[model samples]
Target: MSLVIDIHTHPAFFEAINADEERLHLRQTCLGLYKTGAAPLAHIFNQMKYAGIDRLGLLPLDLTTTHGVELVSNAEIHHLVSLAPEKFIGFASVDPRRKDAVEVLEYAFGELKLSGLKLHPAKQKFYPMDEGLDAVYACCLRHNKPILFHAGISLQPDAPSQYARPEHFEAVALRYPRLRMCLGHFGWPWVVETAALLLKYPNVYADTGLLYFDSAREFYQHVFTRTLGQHWVDRSLRHQVLFGSNNPRFEQIRMVEALHTLGWRASTLELVLGGNALEFLG
Candidate 1:
């Protein structure tokens, strides 16, 4: 089988602290990271082995000092990725409001040799399309790096304003068409809208990170059999969708199984499994 690449997962640490009821949330979130087989700096390799996630992007999320979401520091993420170079891909998270935002980007790209950058507007407390992001995008463009932005749902129960709609990225993409942007979770609520944007900006693409794997398969199955005919699978076979298990939320291998159960065309399956990611990240 071709290697399975989960484009959006955090093999590195999460906000392990700062929960109101740390003891309880740890029962799920922190301890749950362990259940997902995600680990801190030291155990990443073993976790990857146990989880059978051929490749995982050690994604990080940042907080803006206001919303008390315990966010991971980019420094910690850089250290983790440096320890195990190949099994992981690091996307350094940044606080757009940080006075040293540009400096952080340089350190991450130049010194750490990380793969990309991750931004969560909801968590970072800024609009992805806000003019504040212009310089950041220019920096990424200069280095030819991609960005993974949380465009769909808020992973936390913080203030509602934390959630940003997918179109929030339209301005940025339109302005910096040269910069690559990967919408995590396929920008769910705006999944179709995201797809439309991809047509205009080829630099934009997304992966099926946390899209309820089985449900995704069934949905696609319906599209294949009912709406688009039996060849639908063959037709969408070339689309840019890639399979990803959100780890702590769901297991990786289950995603692999879901695709197989849907009877996705072999070539298409290979593409979604890892082929597309390899090329996209290239």
Candidate 2:
């Protein structure tokens, strides 16, 4: 089996939230998650074991400027990675709208030793092409870090989907051709546009984190087979697609099983499930 890596996961609910009230508040306000209670570390390990996931790319959302909260702080991610450095790949989050955003990213990369950067244009309320973010983008490029952008729909209240459209990232891609980036959730509902970007830019990629309606298998069939054409990934974008479960919102096991049902070739599955992520992270 190829090394399996889940490239999209929010670990805020797993051993990150301390107080029940805090967890509840985050669930309601920041995360839009109804699932109550914090999951112990063991629960996540068990889930990974059952799902055949070798590592998790833990993502944090720094919504301090827009929502006055850090969905999961950089420090907390560092702590979680510290607990099991071999099992977790920590990504840093910074509010790009802040004047100190570049500085914060510097600390995250230099001091915390995070692997990459995760940003949410919809939740952060910033345009991907905004000049204000030039410094932040430069910082990531300077550190040779890839970025995972929250593309497409957002479950959080007040997070508009318009800001995360796949087209909005073209300019950034054009400017920083060397900086690798993944459009999270496959830019669902605009899957074609996402595919276009992936085709046009070598540095651009997408992840299979979308689960909007119905069973995972059904949804993936609709998106990957009917909507995007059955052989699109296997034929064209195998090297650019990464396996992402968007866990905490959806179960990793379900997404993994659903992806397997897509009828892709073994080589294609190897790329999507792990090989592609390894390249993206580099």
Top lDDT hit: 2
Error (Å) of candidate 2 at residue 235 is: 0.6
lDDT of 2 by residue, 1-282 (tens): 889999999887775455566655665556778654577888889989999999999998898888787778899899999999988999999999877899899999999999999999998999999999899999999999999999999887888999999999999999999999999999988899999999999899999999999899999999999999899999999999999999888767998999999989999999999999999999
Q: Give the TM-score of candidate 2.
A: 0.97
Local distance difference test, candidate 1? 0.66
RMSD of 1: 4.4
Mind giving the per-residue lDDT tens digits that candidate 1 earns over 129-219? 7777888888888888888877777554442433567787788888887787877766765666666666667777677665443564575
Over 4 Å off, model 1 = 12-52, 68-70, 159-163, 212-239
| Residue 20 CA displacement from its true place in model 2, Å | 5.9
Best candidate (score: TM-score): 2
**How does each model score on TM-score?**
0.79, 0.97
- Against the reference, the lDDT scores of all candidates come to 0.66, 0.91
Off by over 4 Å in 2: none
